[model samples]
Target: MNKCVGTTEAASLLGISSRRLRQLLEKGRVRGAYKTGKFWIIPLFNHLPQITKGTRGPKGKWRTSRPPALAKINVNRNHIGSNIKKSPKDRKPVISVKRKGTNLYGNEVEILGPCKIVYQPDNPLDCGARLWIDLRSRYANETFSDIHFIGGSFPATR
Candidate 1:
């Protein structure tokens, strides 16, 4: 029979923590290691098992696969509001609006743009749609009773 040592002695010899040795023993990563009574018996001559390093978390299709393409939005002229018309001639040069907020992924996101949607990703993981509106716009500063959309009107915020 091979000479065996306790987990503490084996951990010290292997230059690792006793708790880490216990984990390795439990996972069957430690060679010539076995449980006896309430303690672990590791062979004295055994070395630390080779551990392959790769991506830390679980492997899934999201790691190797590309995100889906963004859906194209076709704007109908009849559905557009008179005030909110999409005319290149009526478009004005506005200052960039910057806002800092947290995304659904709990990441700190800083958005900078004019009075329109700044970024619309090709494929969104959390929310499919992201509308960025500048609060410094002329209409934003004015006190409006209701805000008009393409389909309906919404209550304005104070």
Candidate 2:
């Protein structure tokens, strides 16, 4: 007659947890395992039972069909700026600085005048570069690379 053992001893011999062995018995994965009353009787076999890998739950409907296509968006690059316009209340007030002192390069610097603050999303240096390029293009005869800021009390915009 073959020897039999409880779940605990059987799990120890099989190098698995008692709960896992109980689950295996419940799922009929273990060949010689049976439930007697509240306890389980597992036959002591020389080799461990082979448990094949399979999907955990019921098959998904997604496997049989393709996913829905996303809606396509048409965006015009030039008009993108128009959509990002902020109301006058939400805008940052322009900073006004009086030009007086010479910069480190010894070039006389001056604030041309207060201008509307230009919004540049990602890189702040790009905004400065864009302004410099604009100034260079506008006043082709004048040099603007040495323009520097001088200290002054700026009045807040009402």
Candidate 3:
């Protein structure tokens, strides 16, 4: 459906930052609307530039160019190795995310990660999560990719 999406919503939908989205609008690559004192809105057009979901936005202009092949890297999400039982005073599950990796541009990416939702009491399953490392390379041949959460019973909560 063609909906008039707000700047922030459009950015989230395209998986690009709001700043990047504004730049694209400024370049006239993707059409958008802005008032004197209001938020910019991107019209849902039929022929908008297709940015792959979760792929980082191009740095400068939106040109017709392909990206390079990114090397296949394996992401491992391990548990604490040792399960620690919470004392009677402390009552909370122990499952935290540990994310660390590099982007296509070799930028250091690290995050504390999100906490898992407890469906049942004290379910100590380490629900693995995958985060897409964004590359800051403006080159036309930089490998743009997304993180795929695999190997876990529960789906990774974004």
Candidate 4:
């Protein structure tokens, strides 16, 4: 199907921000779009033009890499330096867990522990982040989709 759409509509169809689409149009990057009467009309059924070299206009104004005045920020890395550190006489292996998201009942949920961020695909949409805890926990790698709500048989997990 062949169709011409306005800038914002084309951007929505392309899954990109409208301003970024306009920037592409202004830079002559969008393949099947043209400026007509001060408006860029984009053709449907065409791939969004790639951002090429020099498409971005003049460089942003120069600024210091760091703020002029700042306090010392302490970033704690827990498990990263495990090999280098000396251990106590005897200590238990602490199980650290981080969690997010509310139960099916719409209550707020939280978890406290050391933090390590990793990217994973198949994450659920239409909700907060999915939580992955120790394998033994009842809610390991649980998201809203995993909650079984058949006939209200089971109480919500908090």
The lDDT leader among the candidates is 2
lDDT of 2 by residue, 22-137 (tens): 77777786667778899987764432333333348653211122222111111123333543586644443232222332112111234352223233445534223232222322
Candidate 2: segments with Cα more than 4 A from true spot:
47-158
Instruction: Give the TM-score ranking, best first.
Output: 2, 4, 1, 3
Pick the TM-score winner: 2
- Candidate 3 per-residue lDDT, tens place, 47-119, comes to 2334323336445443224333342322332222222454433432222223243322111222232222223
Cα deviation of 101 in candidate 2 (Å)? Answer: 86
For all predicted structures, in order, the TM-scores are: 0.29, 0.31, 0.28, 0.30
Runs in model 4 lying further than 4 Å from the true structure: 46-158
Instruction: Estimate every model's Cα lDDT from 0 to 1.
Output: 0.40, 0.42, 0.40, 0.42
Residues 5-117 of candidate 4 have per-residue lDDT tens digits of 78886665556688877877887766677888998877654323333345356842322121121111111133224524645522222222222432232112232322233
* Global CA lDDT computed for model 4: 0.42
Q: Per-residue error at 54 for model 4, in Å?
A: 7.3
**Candidate 3 segments exceeding 4 Å error:** 32-36, 46-158
Higher-ranked by TM-score: 1 or 4: 4
lDDT of 2 at 32: 74
TM-score of 1: 0.29
lDDT winner, 3 or 4: 4
